[model samples]
Target: EPEVTQTPSHQVTQMGQEVILRCVPISNHLYFYWYRQILGQKVEFLVSFYNNEISEKSEIFDDQFSVERPDGSNFTLKIRSTKLEDSAMYFCASSEWTGELFFGEGSRLTVL
Candidate 1:
């Protein structure tokens, strides 16, 4: 089966550095979402984009965060400044919402 692809499954960054986590969403899906799990916490929604613009964004998505569909095949999340608390599993997901989702294994961000 085809799968979502994410880069740098594990990332280590010092506090305050910029980081870009990348993903390739499944083709034919109409919705894309980014969620994060802060080490042992429940998954939290950061944002959802559809029709090429943000459809919804949680409060957690602030100045430090941004997302884009840089091309027809790629979606990306950029963190302008990293913080220790920012360390977590960042997941990119696509769904019909029709039902569940196909999630990239995830980009694990580690800020030290």
Candidate 2:
């Protein structure tokens, strides 16, 4: 079965540099989302994009973050300025909301 793929499964970056996490979702999905889970917190939605516009976003998706669908198969999250607290498991998920979710293994971001 085809699934989402994220590069660097793990990334370590400095506290003030920009970092972009990449993902390739299932071929047929039209909706794309970014979510993160801090050490002991619940999964939180960052943003959702479709039809080339942001459908919705949570408070955590502040000015420091942005997302893009650069081509037919890639979705990317860019953080303009990293923070130590930015460390977490970034999950890329896709579904038509039929109550099922397919998630990427996750890209672990560790900022220092």
Candidate 3:
């Protein structure tokens, strides 16, 4: 079965810098989401998108963060400015509807 794929499996950046994480979700999935796990913490939802519009977003997704589907197959998340608190493992997920989600290996972000 085809799975979600993410680029830059690991990234390191300085505080106040910018970072962009990229993913290619399962081709047939309609809903996409970005979630993050900070160190040993639980996974936290950031945003959800469908039909080229943002369906829902958590408080963690502030003005500094943005998500885009630049083309048919790519979904991207951009962090305008990085912060030490933003260090986490970012996961890209997709689902055909609202049910099961297929997730990528995750891109670990480390901010110093």
Candidate 4:
């Protein structure tokens, strides 16, 4: 049973600081995505990647954010600058063609 794995399960950073969240999706999955949940809000989609290119992105994924597959198995999301409102639980998910998404435990980002 393979699953998505994320790093830095919990991170505390100052406002305007930079943060990078890492994830490793299931080896056989083709599509990957970065989604976030602000404290008590609904899950929001940030970006999606497939075939080594960005497939789609939400408005919430502004210029401050970037996604990359630096290597074959590692997918990452980098926030150029953190804001107080940026605090949320970022989840990394993957699926074999947009069917069922397997998600990681999520990396919690807390900005002060």
Query: Which candidate should be chosen as best, given lDDT against the real structure?
Result: 3
Q: What's the TM for model 1?
A: 0.94
Which residue ranges in model 4 land beyond 4 Å of their true spot? none
Residue-level lDDT of model 2, residues 18-77, one tens digit each, is: 999999988888888899999899999999878777889999999999999998789899
**lDDT tens digits, residue span 1-112, model 1:** 8788999899999999999999998888878889999998999999998888988999999999999998877889999999999999999998876267889999999999
| TM accuracy, model 2 | 0.94
Weakest ten-residue segment in model 2 by summed lDDT: 93-102
lDDT of each: 0.92, 0.89, 0.97, 0.96
Give the 10-residue window scoring lowest on summed lDDT in candidate 3: 94-103
Query: What are the per-residue Cα lDDT tens digits for candidate 3 across 1-112?
Result: 8999999999999999999999999999999999999999999999999999899999999999999999989999999999999999999999998889999999999999
TM-score of each candidate structure, all chains considered together: 0.94, 0.94, 0.98, 0.98
Looking at model 3, how many pairs of residues clash? 0
Model 3 Cα shift for residue 61 (angstroms): 0.3
**TM-score-superior candidate, 2 or 4:** 4
Which portions of model 2 miss their true places by more than 4 Å? 97-99
